[model samples]
Target chain A: MSPFVLDDRLERDSEFVTALGLCQLRLLKDSRWPWLMLVPQRAGKTEIFELTPLDQAMLTFEANLVAGALKQVTGAKKINVGALGNIVSQLHVHVVARHEGDPNWPGPIWGFGTAVPYDNDRKHAFLTALNEAIGS
Target chain B: MSPFVLDDRLERDSEFVTALGLCQLRLLKDSRWPWLMLVPQRAGKTEIFELTPLDQAMLTFEANLVAGALKQVTGAKKINVGALGNIVSQLHVHVVARHEGDPNWPGPIWGFGTAVPYDNDRKHAFLTALNEAIGS
Candidate 1:
């Protein structure tokens, strides 16, 4: 795999917001909750270790920055940050903003229910707000 | 605060293991179900991004190593790997081995039960096996 190829599907996805730091910040395809994904610009990167030390710092700082923005935009009760490399091998960290009484309360978010895709307007609006918060 | 200074009692009291590459391996003071922590050592670390790219990769590699060792050592049905900075404001990741019928079964592990300090023999056995598995 080339080191810098961006998956076309991932690039065209409307759910993600392109951050000023050049990382693709996408909301998870699921709408069961307010979940966001931060995919660093580097390609062919299945693991966090694939990037250089400086890039690692960028991802980590971006994760925190994105998490804070999501909290402000969504007003969630708890924020869950994880990079479970079980399914999608891409190096993406999930910043899920969990609210009280969310589906599958007090349980793992996986395998709870089918993900509900966002409406066109809602998705666009979310992307805009996230970008604004990220100051992108 | 100095970049490497950790103020939490757990952070202060943790026993540094020979499992350097196997992640930050530490026996929970309260030995409820062979709990272990895997904190990747990186300075100026606030989130995963604070890590240099190389350190980030090393953290994941070490995290997987500890995850495998924890399963073998504890026979846990669920292995929880998370970096929640709500309590300890560091970039350390937790690799907790959990069982289905455990005290916090099918629920969050936080505030589930009082911590049970590890007995001497068990503590010795756990760390010994972990070190052997890590082989340094």
Candidate 2:
């Protein structure tokens, strides 16, 4: 298994919070947008294709489950799912909720604004609410 | 094999265009944002998972292949891949190249602005270039 150390980017990212479930379901600390980061428990794995077929299934299942719950909680009109490891190069999936009037409306959400760091109380509330939403 | 028909959305959106390849690749024609719409040879299917496992693999491979070429052409900082059936519900994958200064920068690409129809020449050029890049 790839050792589980948050890459400097993810670790220093005030946006990353605690994981929620047994599946290493970590919440990205990004509060500007309702985003979730899921890292399946496999070491040194950087791509979805890198996982065993069974693990791939698990990841897809969990990703879909969380994507649905996040949509319900965020009430986002659209949900964006992707794995762009260009910067982090880790096998993490991003599930972002998109709204109609978001800053980068109708555009890809990559190089938009400065990463809005999350504060402690807000982070706590968001994570707590997400956990409640998923009933985990 | 699923029968193929031009999606109505493809017809209405002047920005929609067909990909130059042995496969049925079509996209939103006028999206200056390097947005591609890949319509597989299926009738009334929306989600990528709906395809047979082999078809899914082929589509994913094709999408990634296009994404790589787009990155080279656009030098986008990030590439976003998604399949949202809210509007078309047809099994089409979106591979959009995102730059930092894009209109929808730092946000999801939905409800942003009116679709800018591509000029015939530019549209032809893009398709031609894409074909060359894909070596079709």
Alpha carbon lDDT at B93, candidate 2: 65
Which clashing pairs does model 1 show?
A16-A26, A49-B57, A52-B53, A53-B52, A53-B53, A57-B49, A60-B49, A61-B49, B18-B136, B30-B116
- Candidate 1 per-residue lDDT, tens place, B15-111, comes to 5665475245666666766666766655456566456656766776676667677767777665665665555556667667677677655554544
The list of candidate 2 runs beyond 4 A from truth reads A1-36, A39-80, A83-91, A95-136, B14-23
- Candidate 1 CAPRI classification by DockQ: incorrect
Candidate no. 1 TM-score:
0.60
Cα displacement (Å) at residue B84, model 1: 0.5
